[model samples]
Target: MGRMSDEPARWTRATVYPDMWVDPADDPRDGASPDGELATLLDFLSGYRMTLRMKCEGLDAEQLARRSVPPSTMSLLGLLRHLAEAERDWFNWISDDDPLPKLYGERDGDFDGAVGEQAAVDAAYADLEREQAATDAALAEHPDLGERLRKDGIAVRELMVHRIEEYARHCGHADLLRECIDGRVGQ
Candidate 1:
């Protein structure tokens, strides 16, 4: 059973993913090397992605599909599915220029995979894991983080800082969405 609603609030705040939360990396002032900013960013992204996954850990199929906020079709499961597509879109299509077609049926239904049942949820997560792995491997293949990618004739870093930004932004969304779902917040 869940905690009694009538119980006095013993805790000042709830965390979105208490068990999954990680302390920030050592500050740059600790005499550590100033290099590896890309690596640091990537680590942060990986942590946040795991946090997003952890936030949905115990929810069932229906609970995962439940819209935590009103007037919004976004669900925790939907965010997961969307982020997965987003990862592929940026890394596979934009960064590595893979000619592979998109997943999740049609273009508009990327997030729709989050709906239906537990099987759908599992599949979405699996897709995300696979895509993330491939992307990571691709990133590893390129040692030059400063390599410029010609995107529409504009140069972009191959280090994936933009993808890190994307994950951070969406993780913020996930934090709020999870909070609305069960009053969970923090981290």
Candidate 2:
């Protein structure tokens, strides 16, 4: 057999000009140095959401919905839809407001029904933005992280951390998927 190739066993993120997301110093989301726990948590959550949005930026509908990975229904469009639903669900859980009816009734419907169409892509982004704004507004009404409002009695701190974790996890997925789509990687 021929000698093995000299490439590293694990891949490192590329830092080429086209692959560069933005200069670390130039990144606008670095303003997370808040003075309190709630501010810090909200800043991190918003940063991750912005990261996901950056991953989806500049892609067309078909690219956004491209199920480029086989056997995984995790297109960027689907992620947008899923996050929208998640925000809505959590907002309802933590507040006394009436939530909009389920966007996708089935468990995986958000990802499953994510068709590669401009309208669907637009709707998903719009829903995610609207739901996230509403959730933030609802959350702002409660000043204490320990406050419990919903039936499950989940504390605001727990709920906020969960939201941050959820977005962070999906952002990892989004980074990989975006790289697979166009060989673009970022810091």
Candidate 3:
């Protein structure tokens, strides 16, 4: 017995709660109380990261790279690339004497170059994971949230908050893009 001929090509919602992405018990975000400012910020950041991954789950290269809301080039693949680039910049900024070059070249290259190809999709995920790990390590170097990234730049706390804000915004775009591709919707 294999997949029925009448079954959809891709998996659709079949949870007890039809409107959500997954059952509450299966959600990956941590529910434990954070211990401090740094812990709280990190929790939010981690949750947003999981949310973005959840939005991109089960998508193929074409679906991941599909643009959403006419006139906007935003896509889940693009967001993944953009976030990777962002992590490199912000995390490395603290130790750099000068500004680093864009990971994808041009300012909008992350979104503009998000082609629907298996290699591109694989690269995006790899880049994001590598960058995220590096960023986390860089962030851990300075336990002080008040530590300034640069003499005239913002502090670690501010940078962390900004990074979370960026993820939250892009995750919103991911949500819409995923829904447009398939009609799946959830928090």
Candidate 4:
């Protein structure tokens, strides 16, 4: 039976697949294995991005901005903003030809400014979309992963690997935060 309106929130939702957030048939992530190094990295990044979004799905602005653990201001919304800023910093701003300012005023502004307001939530998502597109476009300009950015001495391959690491770590955080929020877990 479905939940009743008068009942309190349950720790876990009743589902056929209790260990996963979605059924395998309904999962949005591209499950197919990749053929090359670049494709593999891209695939993992794409899946992590989708996973982060799924973790935040059905959550309201207040829930999105809820603090993670004690003494840490990090939240789903903050992660979104931080990732957007990171995409710009690593891809666009690092290139000398298109150096740009931080999306937020300061380095920690993403987490510090995260508020439980609809406007803030909407802005964070929009900024993420814009920054992701800009970053992708900038990366497309340099097909050779061995080529270094004009400003940063690191190769594109290193940058891609670093981004994957960053996303994977944050996705783990998202998983814990989401579980604490509603008792949902898996995948």
Which digits, one per residue and each the tens of the lDDT, describe model 4 over residues 1-187?
Answer: 9756632343444366767787677788947889988888888888888888998899999999988878998998899999988888886644666468888897699999999999999999999889888777778787788887765477888888888898889999898878767777747
Instruction: Supply the global lDDT for candidate 3.
Output: 0.85
* TM values, all candidates: 0.73, 0.86, 0.88, 0.88
Positional deviation of 17 in candidate 2, in angstroms? 8.4
How well does candidate 1 match the true structure, expressed as C-alpha RMSD?
5.7
Ten consecutive residues with minimal summed lDDT in candidate 2? Answer: 6-15
Clashes of 2: 0
Alpha-carbon lDDT, every model = 0.65, 0.83, 0.85, 0.83
Which ranges in model 3 have alpha carbons more than 4 Å from their true place?
1-14
Clashing pairs in 1: none
Model 3: how far residue 68 lies from native, Å: 0.7
- Supply candidate 4's per-residue lDDT for 11: 48
The sequence of per-residue lDDT tens digits that candidate 1 reaches over residues 26-71 is 2221233335766566666766777787667666887677675566
Off by over 4 Å in 4: 1-16
Model 3 clash pairs?
Answer: none
**Which lDDT value does model 3 have at 156?**
89
Residue-pair clashes per candidate: 0, 0, 0, 0
